[model samples]
Target: MICVGKLLGVKRRLQDMTDALSDMEAGNGNRRILAVGNEPTADLSYKMNEIVTRYEEQLSGLRAADETNRRLMTSLSHDVRTPLTTLIGYLDAAHRGVVTGKEREEYLEIARHKAHDLKDYIDVLFDWFKLNSSEFALSIERAELAELTRNNLKDWIPIFEENHLDYEIEIPERPLFAKADPDGYARILNNLVQNVIAHSRATRIKIKMKQKEKEIEICVEDNGIGIEKADLPHIFERLYKCDKGRSDQGSGLGLSIVRQMVEKMDGRITVRSEPNRVTSFTICFPVKN
Candidate 1:
């Protein structure tokens, strides 16, 4: 019942409505008009404000999480370092003859051993921070595997003897060359052997290496109280402890560091266990022929 002129006006209004919606969708809102030259808009402004509010909230949450991590790292650094400094100082004093006799010798031995354990723990903590903060780079090169293993074994022989651990190091007569970082490979072996000595509580532990055409598999096996299935998956996680109460003799960082070091070498580490029967950590790394 509208006149032709009124119909044309209604059509124009429909066009304006379509244009406004299109402009909003395309984020070209300078063209949208709520009130012409004297423009004053409420609805559109409210929508934009709401979007900004949500974005700000999300950013705030991220910042808060970052701050919490910083605080945790700072506190951990302070707490762990203090006791370590004191332990090292006392051990040095005892070794330097500030104390003497069998009693002093025993105290010094305990101090030295515990200081080494504390050092291992701090190294793990710093490595954890690095692992989380940086991306891993595989800097591989050709190196003799047997020589590397021999040197590491020699370095740890004293510790093994001191702890009364019977270590059986099995290596091939001829050296096998592998592509990997010498330091990284050494750390992998050290962590595994250290775990065997510290947590395995086994009188005898073995390091067995298998060299194949494409990869090398090494395992540190022990006769010890094995890990539960539930604890296996979590053991590799950062700062996770499996023994409901931490093992009295260990820093709890050994296995975690082992996992990280294996991955850094482009290797895989897996554990197999039977409670009080045997526990073995197997690692495989690509070998350079």
Candidate 2:
């Protein structure tokens, strides 16, 4: 009689466990093994519960990732299409002779600017794609950090002047050598500077660099409409946009690309901002021995 009773208890526990597992496999992630106290199969129940918990966590993460990708596609459509449509409108007006004389010249210039804007947006999209892909390659080498930065910023001087932006640059006389990809570094600088130009309504900008212990520090500062506190934390996140009143000009990929390039070169980027006062982005790289 005791032997029969023991077998019946064992059978009941097995049946319960089998039903729980079936429920879990049928997409009921909330289903859990209910281990009967002191039962022979309690240990198996605990192990099964652990496995199900992990499975649920993985499924949740995958769902979140899929949602993010869906949002990105929506943003891509709006960002790429808006400027493209405007560019087409301007070109059509120009080609159809909708204006003449100096008016025509102004229309042509506006069309040209819009065309450049479209190209820049497309370039940012391509850069984002490349950075996220496995095949993206970097050519890292030891280079004179100060010299490379100076060469890159020189081109921006005229642009700053054209925009009537006051600027100051400070670089140490001593050679600052760092291991980095020159092209990537240049892109980083360009994106930061362009951010100030295109978004920050600032009259003065500063670029400063120096050696800090074993690291080389480069700072890009602007006395512009700085980022709000809420947006600062997310500026580097892919596709994140500030809610502040600054113009939403780019494809929202510039800062994201900047961060990826910095990390690929074994460096990091940080930003600090005081609204309408000062906004600074600092890049730190390990100095090459």
Candidate number of the best TM-score: 2
Off by over 4 Å in 2: 1-17, 30-54
lDDT per residue for candidate 2 within 1-289, as digits (tens), equals 5598888988998999999888888989999988777888889999989999998999998998788678778888987788778878877887899977788788888878888777777778888889878999999999799989988999999999989999999998889999899998998999999999989999999999999888999999999989999898899987777889356666677999999999999999999999989999999999997
Best by lDDT: 2
lDDT of 1 by residue, 1-289 (tens): 7688767855665566567667656754344434333223345445654664565577678887687577657656765777677777777778788778887787777777767667777776666566557575546788788878888889888988988988788888788877778887887788788777767678878888779878887888888776777787777754455773225444455677778777767778898887678888888888877
Query: How does candidate 2 fare on TM-score?
Result: 0.87
Residue pairs in candidate 1 whose N, alpha carbon or C atoms collide under 3 angstroms: none
Give the deviation of candidate 1 from the true structure as CA RMSD.
9.5
Cα lDDT of all candidates, in order? 0.71, 0.89
C-alpha TM-score for every candidate: 0.67, 0.87
Relative to the unseen true structure, what is the C-alpha lDDT of residue 73 in candidate 1, on a scale of 0 to 100?
73
